[model samples]
Target chain A: MTVKLYIDSIHDALQEEMRRDDGVFVVGEDVGVRGGVFRVTQGLIEEFGEARVIDAPLAESAIVGVAIGAAAYGLKPVAEIQFADFILPAVNQLISEAAKMRYRSNNDWSCPLVVRAPYGGGVHGALYHSQSLEALFHHVPGLKIVMPATAADAKGLLLSAIRDPDPVLYFEHKALYRWIKDEVPEGEYTVPIGKARCVLEGDDITVITYGLMVHHATEAARELEKEGISTELIDLRTVAPLDSEAILAAVRKTGKVLIVHEDNKTGGVGAEVSAIIAEKALFDLDAPISRLCGPDIPAMPFNPPQERFYMLNSEKIAQAMRQLAAF
Target chain B: MMNAQSLEVPAMIAKRHDKLGLTDHDVVKMYHFMLKTRGLDDRMWLLNRAGKVPFVVSCKGQEAAQIGAAFALNPVRDYVLPYYRDLGVVLVFGQTAKDVMLSAFAKQEDPNSGGRQMPGHFGSREHHIVTGSSPVSTQIPHAVGIALAARMKGHNLVAYTSFGEGSSNQGDFHEAANFAGVHRLPVVFFCENNKYAISVPLRKELACEHVSDRAVGYGFPGVTVDGNDPLAVYAAMKEAVARALDGQGPSLVEAMMDRMNPHSSDDDDRTYRSKDELEEVKSHDPILSFRDYLLDCGVLTEASEKALREEVTVEINVATTYAEKAPYPHPEQALRYVFAE
Candidate 1:
């Protein structure tokens, strides 16, 4: 195992997958020579040449639309939307074309494409750049949404996403790209997409979250532990196909649940998770299921203080956890 | 300034057609497909009015352009991403008359969607025709992507995509044109400019004179031809296909025609179009003009035309009966194919 940054794990996964499958190729804006804005695809152009590592024109719709076509024609295209916010332009292609290709064609064709974007609100990206779009896309049927919190799962989950038969939206948190590091295996390994990992095991309250918020929840869990409140944290690896079984199991064990995410509370994955637990396991819950998420503002503010207030940090999570634990 | 008959079949029309590598039999075959498409469309309108089908999007005046362009491409090798108004194109590309009827009936045997999609959403994997959605111009980028893939795989194949003139204004068209131009991918962006985008006329749809004029910004050749003449559309598509095969990047071929029918069963062109305007456009109908051309060239006789019409009618009848009796998909099967099985 080698200690690597979260971005490095993603890069390694792309390299390994490209080496493993000839059909795998990368296309996006500045992905070739510029090696991507975040440098996650750095050195891929030299290794794979210009044909495989394509630098497309600054058109998100074409980037994804062409990837869908390529995937339909038996090529595994990994398209990058420079920022998750820019993915809206390509949503028609993603939702109408790639997502429905299989069902529309009655299994005669499938789009095995991976769309990777850096998402979440940190680093003061503000309005356009800083946005959590997973909730907007979670309702889609054929598409899989994955956001990994740790470097190890980042590598494994990305590999699995690339190999999956359907289109996968792999959202990487930009804030955790350099801030988070973990030992990822040297060889290939995949974290199953629809399974949640038990980040912290406890008996009092269960914390269900994903992406960078998982770390904040973990910190809050640690703080809660000091106050004699045990917290069980489940890092939901994939959001679309919610691991309801794992969520219910965690909820059954703890009886108190707190869903944390960086996206807005309304219509977020938390709502779906909360709905699932409320419908299936309301009897097991000792306290009402609660969610601490970003406010219903359009986006994160430019100023640091406003941005911090808009985001869900460990303190806010701990505060929520304290209330739920006391209840 | 040329009259419809003169433009349809001039004295040297046969010689010009021969120069383009089309035999007398080939022109007759093209006319046959055009007739079949028109017949199927006419039957669909009738069925729609009689409450047999849910919807009908007629390709009445666009047959020559669609068939002409489809004839130029190697159907077995090349890929086609046809818009909804491409009955003739799909027919020429190997979608059978029965398949069209099945789709119209929304039957379980429908090759396109198995009774899932609306009638006009044409697709067939075996025919190398990419499926399309109802959204205008989305297939343009998809065609560009297929061409990109073909070039990357070192395959000598072109991806042909067709859309209405107004669809050229869509952002997908511009993005696709720019990408194909930048990559020099093998693709032909064929615009069947029927002069209307669902009741909106050509003048309102574009600021420029021609849809093909926008191709210059993408660093590709753009040509506009008379869509009423199959020979003209055939010539344009032939050049576009050749350019694609020679790795000369994509070309935008805009075939200028008129939408003779209302947009669909749900639309009323009378509200937006005049009686004189409709008659003027219908006078240059490609099917009738092409038939005249064939007759003038001695490629089609009155007796032979009658026999061909009879054959098409029989074919349509058989397909219609088969599809009408075909079962609807089982109610429980609605949840199927949402994921790969």
Candidate 2:
């Protein structure tokens, strides 16, 4: 097993998928010559020809629209949006065209494509580079939303997403790209979508999270362990078609729940999770379904104090857990 | 007017004969297509009135340009991405009369949509027709990609896309033209300028006199043709397709026509245009002019014309009955085809 980072897992998964399936190819700005801005697609143009590793114009909407058509035609295309924030330009295609193609057309067509983008705050990438918009996509039907928090999950989920017949938005947390590392499988393997994993098992309150927030949630759980909190941590793999079964089971055992994510509090995935708990496992809850989320703002600021205040962190998760346990 | 003043029409008509290179047989086939399309359009209106088909967009006056483009291509070879108004093109491209009628009735047998889509939303994977969404101008870039794919495969096959003048104002149109022109892909961008987008007139939409003129900005040959004249429209489409097949690049051909009906079954045309304007549009009807031309050229006799109309009437009746009898798609089908699974 190779100890690889999350970004490295993306590169390996893409290279392996491209080698395995002739129909699979990668397309986006700087994906060819530049190996992607984050270099997740490094050495791909060399391994696969330029046709397989296409470098498209900077037009975001064209990148998305072309991928949809190409996927419809025959080829399985994976388009990279350089930054998750910049994906707003192509949101029309994602929301209206790609997402609706399968449903509105009554399955006469399927947009079997992947749109990969780096998201999250920290690493000093201010404003447009750091927004978490997975919640926006998770609300839309006909699209699978993936946010990997580990190298292994990244590789497995990437492979699964590439092979999935439906359109998927694969959000790679830029903060976790190199910071988080794990032993990824050497060959082909895929983790099914809509499944969560127990990062840590405990008897006290359960902390459910994903993406970069998973790290913070884990850290919070570790710190709480010394105080005998014994927190159970669950890392959700895909937000849409979420692992509600796993979550409810965890909540039933731990008898308490605290949902955390990097996205804003208003209309975020946390609220949806809270609602799911209320609907299914309400009586099992020891306290209210607490949520630790980013402030209701666009994104984190460049200023250290303001940025730290805007985004959710380990301390916030720890504090939220303490408050929930007290209740 | 003299035939010479018509520039391309008479010459193009004389160049090809029966059974090959768009012969008299092909012309009659196209005429048959027009009859079928008009029959379907008329049936749709009746269905809507009778509350059988929920909605319909009748491509009545615009049949010539739509059918002409369809006649110019082999459906198995070429890909067509057309807007809602090209119901005639859908028929000419081998979408069955029954399939179209079933789609209008929202039945399981509707090959285009299988009861999921609105009327006139045509898409067929078997014929390589890319599924069209309700969003205007989104199909343009997809057509460009098809052309690009053809070039990538080193094939001479061309991808054809048609939309109205209203869609030309969209940014996707420019993106498609730019990509196709810059890449030198095999595509013919056909814009059927019916002079209105829903209720908005062409003059209010664009400052340019013709939509084709916008194509010059993208470094391709752009020409405007009399869309009401099937021969002229066919000639222009043939030239564009030939240019693309010869590896020259893409071309934009604007076919100027008029919409004789409202935007759709739900729209009321009388609310927007005056009686005189509607009458003027009717005078330039493509089907009438083409029939007159066929009569003058001795290609069609009065008896044959009457017989053809009756034949189309019978065919339409049969298709309607078939559509009405087709079962509704099972609700479990809702989960099916959401993916390739």
Candidate 3:
């Protein structure tokens, strides 16, 4: 195992996958010599020629649309949308074209493509640079959404996403790029999609989250231990096809549930998680299911005070856990 | 297929085909596909009116442009991403009359989408006709991507995509063209300028005089040709294809045609179009003009024309009957194909 930053693990996945499959190519803005906006695709251009690592024009729709077309032509294309907020321009391409390619064609054609973008707030990126838009794509049927909270999961999940037979939207929390590091396996350790990982197993209160929130929740859970409250934590690696088996099992173990996310509360993925828990595990709950998400404001502001208010921290999560633990 | 038309072509008309590397048989085949497209389109409209089909998007006046450009493509080696009114293009590329009918009838056996999408949403993996959606100009970038793939794979192929003049104004068109131009991808952007985007006229669609003129901003050569003359359209497409294959970059070929009918069966031309303009469009119908040209060249006689017309009608009728009797997909099938099993 090699100790690597969360972003390097993702870079290793792309470089390794390109070496493994000639059909795989990269396309995005400044993904070439400039690597990516976050250097996630650094050195890919030098390793594989410009043909494989394309520095695409500044058009999100075309970036994803071209990837969809390349996927249709039997090529594995990894498209990057620079930022999750800028991905709105490609919503139609992902929802209408990429997601519907196989279904609309009745299985005659399929798009094996990956659109990776960095998401989440707390980096003072204001509105455009920092926004979690996974729920928008999570609502789509044919598209799969994944947000890994660790370097190891990031590498494994990214490899699986690229090799998956359908389109996948990979959202990386920009805050975890260099702040987080973990021991990553050397080669070929793809964590299967549509599965949730259990973290900090306990029996007092249940906390379900993914992406950057997973780390914050872990820190919060560790602090809750000092208060003699055991927290059952789950990191949902794949958000679309939720790992209901693990989630229900976790909820059944602990009677209370608290869903955490950096995205907004109204119509967020937390709502879907809440619905699922309420549907099957409602009877098992000792208290009402609660959701700790960003406020209903349009987006996180750039100011320090408002940004702190708009963002979720381990302290805020610990308070929610304390409240849930008390119940 | 090379019977009287191949031998009886006059010297003047033979030069038209020879200069473009097309044989008399090829043009005859083009004519046949155009007729079949028109017959099937008319049949679908009739079915819609007769309460059999739900909707109809007629390819009435655009047949010449569709078939003409399709003749220049390498159907087996290349990919063609056609728009809604591209029945003629799909027919030329290998979709049979029965396939078109099955889509129109939305039967379980429909190869395009198993009766999922609308009839004009044509797709066939066997024929390399890439699946398309209802959104306009989205296929332009897809075609560009296909070309990019071919180039990366070191394959000598061109990707052809067609859209209406109105769709040329879409952002997808501009982004796709700029991307293709920057990469110098091997793709041909064929714009069938049918003069209308539903009820809106071309004058309001763009500030430019022609759709081809917009290609200059994308760093590619753009040319416009008469859509009524199949030979002219074929020549332009052939040149574009040659440039793409030679790695000179992409080209935009715009073919000027009429919408003929209303925007669709649900539209009312009387509400928007004038009778004088309609009469002028019909006076120079592409089918009639091509027939006259063939007759003057001694390639098509009145007797052969009657026989061909009857043949097309019979094929369309048989396809309609077969597709009409075909069963619809089971209700449970709607949930399928959402993800790969």
Candidate 4:
């Protein structure tokens, strides 16, 4: 195992997968000669040649639509949208075409494509650059949504996503791209999709989260450990096929729950997690499920103070945990 | 097959048909396909009015262009991504009359979607015809992608995608054209310029004169053909297919036709189209014009035409009855195919 930046793991995973499968190719704006604006796909064009690592015109819809067609024709294409906010133009292709290919064709065709985008606030990206769009796709049925918080999960989950038989929307939080680093296993290994990882285990309160919020929750869990409060941290790797069993087990053990995310409050992943706990494990709870999420504003503001307040941090998560524990 | 009787023809029509390289038997086959498509379209309207079928989108005046383009490609190798009103195209590409009836009835035997999608959403893996959705021009990029895949795998195949004139204004069309042009993918963008998009006329759809002219912006050749002349359409499509197979890049071929019927069974076209305008469109109906050309060229006689009509009537009736009696999918199977087994 070797420690690496969160973005390096993703880059390594792409290189490893491309080397493993000839059908696996990457395409997007600036992914080839420019090496992507964030450099996640740096040096891929030199290694894989232009055909495999294409730099497409700046059209999101065409990028995704072409990938869908390629996937249908037996090519596994990993397309990148420069930013999560720019993914709206390609939603029609993703939802109507790629997602429905398997179901509509009645198993005659399948689109094994992955669309990667950088999401979440911080780095002063503002409204157009920083947006958490997991909820927009969570309601879609034929898609799988993955947002990894750690370098190890990023590499493992991406390898799994590229090999899967359906379309996956993989959101890598921009804020955690370089800030987070961990020991990622070498060689080819995939962390199973639709499963959650228990980052830190405790007994007093269960905090279920994903993406960058997992780090904030982990920090808060460490802080609470000093105050005699035990918080169980669960990182939901895949949001669409929620790991309900893992969430329920955590709730049953802790008897208290707190769901945190950087996305908006309404119709977020937190709502779904709360509903699941309320439906099957309502009797197991000692206190009501609490949520710490971004405010219901249009988007993250450009101002430093406003953006800081708009994002969920360790201090806010710890306060929510203390409130839920006291309840 | 042509009958043993030698029928005479006017020299002018014979010269034109001969120039297209279509023999007597090929012209008759093209006529047969057009008639069959028209018969099926008419039956669908009857079924829609009788409350047997839910919806009907007619391809009445576009048969010549559809069949012309279909014949120009190798159905066994090339891929076609046809739009919702491509009944004639799908028929020529190997979808049987029974397949059409099954889709209209929304029966379990429907190959496209197993009764899931609406009628006219053509698809058949065995025939290499890609499935299409209801959206206007989404298939444009999909066709480019398929061609891109073919090029990557080093296959000498082209992808043919078609849409209405109004859909040419859609972003999917332009984006697809740009990508295909930049990559020089083996694709043919066939536009059936039916003059209207439901209620909107072509005047409102675009400020340009012809839809094919937009292909120049993507750095490819664009040609406009008289869609009423199957021979002319065949000539244009034949060249386009050859260029694609030769890896010369994509071409945009605009078949100038008209929509003779209302948009769908539910629409009352009289609200938008004038009686004089409808009469003008019907005057140049491609099926009738193609029949005249065949008769003038001695490829078809009165007796043979009568025999062909009888054959189509019987075929459609048998397909209708079989599809009507077919069963719906079992309720328990509704959730199947959502995920790979």
Which structure among the candidates has the greatest DockQ? 3
Q: Estimate every model's Cα lDDT from 0 to 1.
A: 0.92, 0.85, 0.92, 0.91
Q: For model 2, how does the per-residue alpha-carbon lDDT over A1-327 read when each residue is reduced to its tens digit?
A: 899988998999999898998788887889998999999999999999887788887778878887887777767889999999989878878887788776766666778889999998986777888899888888887888999899999999999998888898999999888898999988987888999999999998998999988888889988999888998899998998899999999899888899998888899998998899999998897788888888887688988888888888889889999887777
Candidate 1 docks with a DockQ of: 0.80
Model 2: how far residue B16 lies from native, Å: 7.5
- Please write out the lDDT profile of model 4 over residues B146-215, one tens digit for every residue: 9988888888898999999989998999999999999999999999999999999988998989998899
Model 2 iRMS (Å) reads: 2.0
Q: Interface RMSD values for the candidates, listed in order? A: 0.9, 2.0, 0.6, 0.9
Look at candidate 3 and tell me the lDDT of residue A60.
95
Candidate 4 backbone collisions, by pair: none
Please say which candidate is ahead in TM-score: 2 or 3. 3
Output the worst ten-in-a-row residue range by lDDT, candidate 4 chain A: A101-110
Better of 3 and 4 by DockQ: 3
Candidate 3, residue B158: how far the Cα is off, in Å: 0.7
Q: What TM-score, to 2 decimals, does candidate 2 have? A: 0.95
> TM-score of each model's B chain?
0.96, 0.94, 0.96, 0.96
TM-score of each: 0.98, 0.95, 0.98, 0.97
Between prediction 2 and prediction 3, the one with superior DockQ is 3
Clash pairs, candidate 3, are none
Measured with C-alpha atoms, the lDDT of residue A86 in candidate 3 is: 96
